[model samples]
Target: MSVEIRRVQSKKEKKSFIKFAWKVYRKDSELKKYWVPPVVADYMKTLDKEKYPLYDHADIALFTAWKNGRIAGTIAAVENRRHNEIHKDKTGFWGFFECINDQDVANALFDSASQWLKAKGLDAMRGPVSPSMNDQCGMLVKGFDSSPVFLMLYNPPYYNNLVTNAGHKIGQELLAWYIDQDLIDIKRLSRIAQHVMKREQLSIRTINMKDFDNEAAKIRDIYNRSWEKNWGFVPMTDKEFDFMAKSMKQVAKEHFIYFVEDKEGRPIGFSLTLPDMNIPLKHVNGNPFTPWGLLKFWWYGRNISAFRTIVMGVLPEYRNKGIDSILNAQISEYGGKHGLYSSEMSWVLKSNEAMSKLAKVIGGIPYKEYVIYEKEL
Candidate 1:
């Protein structure tokens, strides 16, 4: 039967559009063990006209693919003004994509997304990027062994072939590393960090929750400035930064957020790590409101054995100063003392050699990879 492509319209259609992935991966034994069903509420936030401030700066369309009256795939196309404004390019993004290993369905989803973006007057379409790369972007190309970390993506290996066959070429790659306890040499790290800190007047400290607003403002400055030259770079608006801060506060561990300040007390670098909540969320099987599910979530929070480093940045002036190593040492020390057995530093741009080298220096081994694909519209 031919595949049917349709834009999501009604509330009922939206629900099925978001839930299609669960049905596609449900019976796969490999995914069944670790899949934390994607949260419907979270997906809703992306489409909420008022909640997502990004809507003010971008155009988006959500589509689902149907075969034999069943949803076989889904995708979203986004045109981010901030991204285009910063990069000075008319590139649109497509994300939230999924499908069974069916070429016709994949082609239908891609064609719909491409046509949607083309109608928006975009010059090129690149994805699978969320409204922003800061959100979950890229299709999983490697590492199928475990569940994805919180806010990370997971997909079957066949996704790569499906995307490539649909006239998409590799746009970029993101790397995820597994940091096991045995790989880290604490003694060497401490000695190296101590020497580096003493010689360079480097100081690392946890973010001050009491001054969170002020601290976040500083982080925004560094983040926008540090990555200003990156490909597809976009300066997140103040509203967006505040929105992120509010969300992070709910699950953020203070000690896991560290900043490096110079002798003059200017914030030069920062790192933010999040507990691997998926370890516990998986037990809930994607239902958080159920009584037993809530209990399991709380229990898992207390017993989490791993964390994911979500953000790490340094000002342009501080690059190559070994500041990252010092900050990482502090983070590792805190994690070790607090029962964290492993950490994942992830989504590093494949072309970012400096950061990639730093990951290796910290005993991180590349285990998972995600790719962004693009085609001229």
Candidate 2:
């Protein structure tokens, strides 16, 4: 039977696209315990053009692959004008990709998106980024033995085969490192932390909950500018970044959030690590509207035993100035003292050699890997 690819035109088709991952994960027994289901409402918000600020600069189309009238796979094709303007490349992105093992189904889904991009004058296609590089991206090709941390991507091991068979090759590889509390060198952390602060005239503090809106604005200034040179980078508009800050605040932990400022008291660098809320979220099965599920989430938020490092960076001028080490040390010491057992420092790009080497030097094990696939359209 041939797979039929069609544009997602109706609300019912869109619903199927959002919920298709649940079907895929449930069908695989191996993923039962390891997969953490995202809140359905969040997915809906991201897909909503009126809500997701990225749509302000880019155009997107959603497609679904149907076989015998059942949803077989889904993908979103995007043409981000801002990304091309900054990078000087005519490229499109295919993301929110979910598919079964069938090569025909995968090819049909890929072609559906590829053709859309090609029509837009994009010469090369890349991604698994729903809308842009700032959001959840990449396909899991390694580390099926554990659950993903924070907003990282996860898929069955066979996803690699699907993308490869569809004529896509690796565009870039990203990694996640597992760090155990027992291996954290607190004394070393404290020593370097103090010395760096003194030498660089820097002061460290957590986000003031009362002043988070202002703090987030400051971080955005650094975040957008610092990462401008990164591959696939796209600066998030203020509204987009503010929306993300609002979301993170819901589960933000004080100790796990650190911001560094110069002696003159201007923001310069920051690091954010959230509790591994997925540990309890896996039990929700993607349904968070229930009273029991909401209660369970609150309980896990307080008793989380590990953290997932989400974002960390220093201003370009502050780079290689020991700010990175200070942030890493502060995170490790705080987690260790708070009874946390482990953390996943993840999605570090393969091209980021400094961070990759820093992870290893700090007793991190490269436990997982992910990649974005690319092909000329």
Candidate 3:
């Protein structure tokens, strides 16, 4: 029997595309435990052209593979004009991928997305990024024993075979490191941090919620400047940055968000960590707006003990100056004081030697690994 690929054309089809994940996970009891149900309303925003700013600068097509009168897999093909303009590479991306344990279904889904990209004159297809690198990206190739932290991607272990069998090669590997509170020598860390801060004439401060717009702009500037040379990094537009800032602020802890500055008061770097909302989100079961869902959310939310350090960066001029140490030490002190001892430092690129080394120095163990795949179209 041949697999039929159909372009999603209606709201019903879109709903099916998103709901297919439940079916895929239902068959794999082990994988289901680690899967977090994304709030349905929030996930739908990605599909709304007017709602998601990415649609303004990208061309995206959603497709579903059908066999035996049922949906077997789904994929979204994206041609991000902004990414191509910045990188000068004609690359497309496939994301929102979900498939059962059928290679033929996966192949059909990949082939359909590839053809869509090829039609747009793209030279290569790379990703599992829902839209781009700044958002949810990567496929879980390792560490399936625990649930993912907030904003990270996860898939069944077999996803590796499904992708490679469909002709995609590993393009890059991203890491998630876990630092246990007990392993950290806080006193030593503070001593080193103080010495570095004094020598560098740097000061650290928490984010000022009252002056959020101004603070967010500063962080965005540091983020864009610091990550400009990184692999797969595309400068975030003001709107996109603002959108992300708003989402993160909902769960952000003032104590965990820090800005590093020179004595002259010019911001040089920042770190943004949030309590792991996924812990409560898993309890909501994808609907957080309903009365029952809201009640369940509040009940589970109070016990959120996990944290994910989502973004941290330093300006190029500030690098190699131990600014990172100051940031790490501050996070540790604050987290310990608040009874949030451990956290996940995630999605660090394999090519980012400085950050990876810093994580290891702080007793961070590389527990989970994710990979992005690529193939010539």
Q: Which candidate is the best by lDDT?
A: 3
Once superposed on the true structure, which residue ranges of model 2 sit more than 4 Å away at CA? none
Q: Which of the two, 2 or 3, has more lDDT?
A: 3
> What's the candidate order when arranged by decreasing lDDT?
3, 2, 1
lDDT of each: 0.85, 0.86, 0.90
Cα TM-score of candidate 3: 0.98
lDDT tens digits, residue span 247-289, model 2 = 9998898888889999899889998898887777777767766
TM-score of each: 0.96, 0.97, 0.98
Candidate 1 Cα outliers beyond 4 Å, as residue runs:
none
Query: Candidate 2 lDDT (Cα, whole model)?
Result: 0.86
Clashing pairs in 1: none
* lDDT of model 2, residue 250: 84
Clashing pairs in model 2, backbone N/Cα/C closer than 3 A:
none
Writing each residue's lDDT as its tens digit, candidate 3 over 1-377 gives 88999999787888888889988886778978889977777778887777888888998899999999999999999999999999999999999999988999999999999989999999999989997889899999889999999989778889899999988999999999998987888788899999999999989999999888899999999999999998988999999899988987888778889999899998999998889898888888789889999999999998777899998989998889899899999999876787876899998997778889999888999999999999999
Error of 3 at 253 (Å): 1.0
